[model samples]
Target: MINRRNMLRAGVVAAGVAGGVAVAAGPASAAASGKGWVSVLDHYRDAQGQERDDAGAIQAAINAATAMRPVHSVLVPPGEYVVNREILVSGLNDAVISGHGATLTLTGAAATTPGASAVLKITDSERFEVSGLTVVDNERTQPYNGVSIARSSRGTLNGVSVYGVKWTGLGVFDTTPGASTDIAIINCTAVGTRFGISTNGHDVRIIGNHVAMYWPSTAEAAAKGGVWSAPSDYYDGINVLTGSDRTTVTGNTITECGQAGVYTQDCTNLVVSANTVTGCQLRGIEVDGGSRVAVGVTVSGNTVVDCKGQINLVRARDVSVVGNRLANTSAARAASLIAVNVGSSHVSVVGNHATQAHPTFPAVYVIGDATDVTVAANEVVAGTPYQAPASVALLYRSAAGEFTVGGRLLATKGLGVGNAVAAATPGKVVSKIEVFSASGASLGFVPVYQSIA
Candidate 1:
């Protein structure tokens, strides 16, 4: 019988060797993985026993050391190592830079100034994993970004905390003059920044992160104010763009942001599931453009409360909104699910519950030039004169093609709008519009304008 403990140790040893480091044979090594391990304080020491505070030590240990192979890990001891200089980490293929129990803090004179520099910059690396460290960017006082991971593939940041970043907490950019893949962020937190985590990478996964975007005070805004930024628009969550594909945002809690929780643009094959967004000033989830059919976007099992707009899909295609609960705390006219200004086709909305407690509006809305969008299997209920007009549903001004509506309720004082099937080429044959009720009963429907009071 292969013991689970032994299997874990063996897996670590295999990873160590595959990463280009030799497996060390010892009882202590067996605990984590017997491999070439270097201590940040001891291995990269000066003439005296006291370790150097230079960022060069870290770079030398990972990038310049000839004896230390790839797939090696640098262990930082438990202490505050203030980095006054800019550090660049360059690695390739399965390199690990880990903090055992130490705090890697970026310290500089800019912490008292208005313009500093980025703390750590990573470039031209692949299969890199960073864990168990607090990377603080004092750009609030100094004015700079915290950490940037650029041109790296298969990069993973785990149990990391980044705060006080001026621009973005974690900025993953495509700067290699080419493209990279496979980025994952797990158990990370970012606070006090323009954007918590911003990325332009493909195959990305952001899981279990806490982001709080606080507005700069009126005094601070006046001191360091600019035309490009305002007291609003500060986001503490994730913003993704630049033609990103195959992205998954799961198990995250984002609160108190000025703009949005998760805003995605130019993305394809995306999934935003199992997240909690609260106290956002603008919207919760927003998706815009893509090349091919932007399909398979599942927004499921999320709790979105106290936001102006809950889920907004604009200029996107092939979307599935399933099993979500939204509540608007303010008296805004914005619907819980608003497909405004989107020209997408073939959208399926299922199993979503919204409280139109907000005054004078519909709980759900399907507007824009969206074609063949179906609003089925949903529970939308609200009071009289309540804005969320659809106790059950609404399909407004949609370029009609084909609709499959079943198992939904439109609960409002306003009359429900029917599907408007547009012609193929303005003169071509228009397709038929179908409707089904909450109990699967077929309701023979007509066009919105034709269906009267």
Candidate 2:
């Protein structure tokens, strides 16, 4: 067995001609590039051989790069690097693992403790980056993440692809303090994994990623992928778990999932904007409270299609679902376009255009005792009728709901243009809302109104 002492004690290995690896400029320049980069092949070999794993060689290359100053990048060129265990990069600062056209495939080696296994793990590192890599998880069983960054600061995983894992594909976390935490996971792809992208960190950016290939709910689908912590998480796409703050999930495409596309629980000051979510069996976006209270979440400027439940907020506060376009197909399963359930306060479902497929489910459902709720402006109507007088909303237990946010409603002008909603509870006094008409009358009978101020 080749140990770490033996791997690092030996000098840099030269790229031999028998290796059959691709090198651009020649062996001398690639083996030890004095100009800020070194090839992993300089210390690794026999990746194609099944008898020996390339884990030790790859670890050696990374160790060499990190230990030697100015040689900060370990370039893994176009080849398969078979790894049996986690390639741990701890306290690695100002380094890069450039694997643009390379594959890091995990071998079918059974781990004694699969709970502590990952293909690549960057922990307690600063200003480190791993980009343009394809990580294939062939661990033969469950309980392994593809790439995970924990307790790290300013770490980035850009343009990476993770495939075939029962656990998280790309995960970022802030376990402890002392490190300045800011992470970015941009333009990544996760397919056939349990959780496409799971994060519970502050100051994180999850942008322009594609999450698909695992759909759990339908009978036609094979498997599921989703939230890492909760029991309800079956096949989630982008799950931001508890206590994450100042996070941004924008311009991503989440599709074909059993559960929520973008699910945020107990997160504060978060923004979910300009994303496209489609073909999710559950909600396109869900903002709910967990152990902590969820607040200041903005779900704006999104396009969602063919999702059963579009946007949902449960027991949340200071949340806004604004300027989004949600639509469903004619054969879509029945679900609400927007749902604001009990314990939600200071919530505004404003300036959104929602079109539902099934007439049974309303476009907007304000259920139970939500306080200071506002459903104003824009259009919410049935898609099949096309701007007809449709059952646009249902306000249940709204009249008896209390007012926790102490304030007056916005001065009502005329019922604005494109206000195409009919409250389903005819003759039910809807009084809990804060909005007031220009005639000093409470728009209480959110009951039979065709439009709203």
Candidate 3:
């Protein structure tokens, strides 16, 4: 087995007569002026009358390209290239390792460990393009991430199929403190992993990808930290964080994860729209911790069903959650509470619908030191058997917090008895109650106003 780091540093040559011809120009100046293509099969030959192409021989070819002119293409032709160790596809500048209808299938022989099976490990290469190939990492000891891209500027993973990887199909992480900018994933299929596309890059766009997660059992959920941790390696399903900015998660179907479908933490300027999330064990979407720290995010136009909780926003600021539908398609556990909780201020939860709340829980629960939270234009029509509306529609239990609820349809208590502010003292000023609901409502004039009058 070749040490990937040493092979990368030694500069592997592309295999074959065409590769040797290309290398005859010397790896350094082969295509310094124009473009070049390095094919993997060109390096393979019958070793001791064996029929299969040798993995080490292929690695030697890739090793020779280390100091080659910016690789215009690192082509892997259609065939099963069995690897004994992980392959590092590293270089700098607008390089492309295109598979051009080639199948870079990961063989089961490399099942030495979780880290040894990945077909391609991309690093520090900008404007990288990987497409039209099938990468399979068949390891059951742990989930194998298909392609790992890091610190690469403007990376693209398009029309790629990743099979039998554990944690994620496509993963981009900023292991270095330095920021990775402008990553895009389009038209990809990731199966048999915890998450399809897992990213932690700035200006990331995850569009038009079919991402499916493994159906986790209760034990798997707990071991993997719950359904909210879908794509369950560390934190699943596009875990973008650390002040990464401008992430758009749109038009993707994310289902059956251990945790939240879309986990955006500490991001500046984020948007989750036109995405359908279902059968997730935990919250459907979680936007956490971007106060003044990570500002300007919106979660809109999403349909989430059968999730433990629809949405959980904590310590976020300037967030607009509108035009979303939350429904419980499962009868086992109640749909978890939908909340904009703790340290979050100036949030607008309008034009959203929630159904099937827990008997004792409200559809939308607001907690923590949140102030100026607006709950308006929402419809909470309780589930069957009880037409009396969700617990109170909205619960504001934070001490010293101000909430404004209006333009909502409620079937139960308009101003829930225990949730109202205590009556004002003789000279102190108090917030007033306002009700704007349809006529013929039972709680039109709440039977009891639990105020300290």
Candidate 4:
């Protein structure tokens, strides 16, 4: 068994070598065959002790461990180590870097490039695992990332805490499309960064993470005024960007971000489910396809509260937004609980509960040019209507066509007057169409034409 005392004694013996130099040990020195575990402190502590940069020692241990016929584990004991430069781990298969309550602090000049600026960069590796580590970059003036995994597949980053990064905290990126796959980022916490976690890989799972304080503002501004009152900047809790497909983001808590709590742009086959998002400056969850027509996205079983907009999908196809609880305590102005913008098709918004204190905007807003979209089984409660006519639950705007209400063709509109329904007079459109119970009491007004021309 490897305990602290034995490890410390071994480290003392390794430090006693002549010339006080760090050496990369061979396989013969390993404690076990085919399963080697190298302690960073035992083999690589600096001559000047904890006050000096021990990154070289850790890097040497990583290189030595990777050089073994079979890959091994690099154990980082509980201590504060400073790394002035990026630590690169490349081409290592089945390697594990396990930090047992270790904290790696980054200092000095920031690298101009993304790969160099990352505190720990892993490239061209497979089956790598990094867990139980705390990486901090407290220098706000410099751009840095906590971890960057590029061109790496089948990697797991678990139980890591990354904070105070100038740029993204954890980035899983690849140069080519679908180069990186099966990456799992689980139970991680990222705070006070510009972007919490950004991925450009396929089949990635971002589960049970807590991302917070991503708004770009000072503590004084947030304390005196609210987080929303500050000048907003672009930030996302978890961003699944282009080239990422079949990604899953579930059971995460994201709060106080400048942009969407969970955002997917130009990503296909994405799932954002069971997340708690609150106090976001922009939409809570957004699937935006910038002229590319993203397909097969699902946003379901999320709790979104106190956001500017709850859900927004733009130019996407074959999307499903279901079983989400959305609310806004503040008075509404122009945003809705759910907004399906133009060019989206084959969409389903079902079984959602939405409420707003001031009912200025519609609970669900479906814009023009969105085809094959269905909004059903949603319960919406709002206060008195503002400039709009009466309290209507659903608002839709489109060209004259056969419109369906409650799964039946209630009205067919003609092109004589742009707004005229076929069953109605030519120059005048149907307005304030209400749905009532069998008792003839008005349940509420269906979302008929409210100045939609």
Best by TM-score: 4
How many angstroms is residue 301 displaced in model 4 relative to the true structure, after the best TM-score fit?
A: 0.2
Clashing pairs in 2: 194-226, 225-235, 225-236, 226-236
Candidate 1, residue 410: Cα displacement in angstroms equals 19
The C-alpha lDDT values of all candidates are 0.62, 0.70, 0.62, 0.72
Mind giving the per-residue lDDT tens digits that candidate 2 earns over 343-445? 7888877788888879666767776577777766646666432211122231222234432222333346753112224444544533333345666555543
lDDT of 1 by residue, 225-246 (tens): 6211455436547877756778
Name the better of 2 and 4 by TM-score: 4
TM-score of each: 0.72, 0.75, 0.70, 0.77
The residue-by-residue lDDT of candidate 4 on 16-97, one tens digit each, is 1111222333222335223356766555555556432467877877777777777666767666777777788887676667
Global lDDT for candidate 2?
A: 0.70
Count the clashes in each prediction: 19, 4, 29, 0
Which stretches of model 4 miss by more than 4 angstroms?
1-35, 45-52, 114-116, 214-217, 220-234, 332-334, 383-407, 410-453
lDDT of 2 at 434: 35
Whichever of 2 and 3 has more lDDT, that candidate is: 2
Candidate 3 TM-score, true structure as reference: 0.70
What does the lDDT read for residue 147 in candidate 3? Answer: 78
Worst 10 residues of 3 by lDDT: 17-26
lDDT for predicted candidate 4 compared with the true structure: 0.72
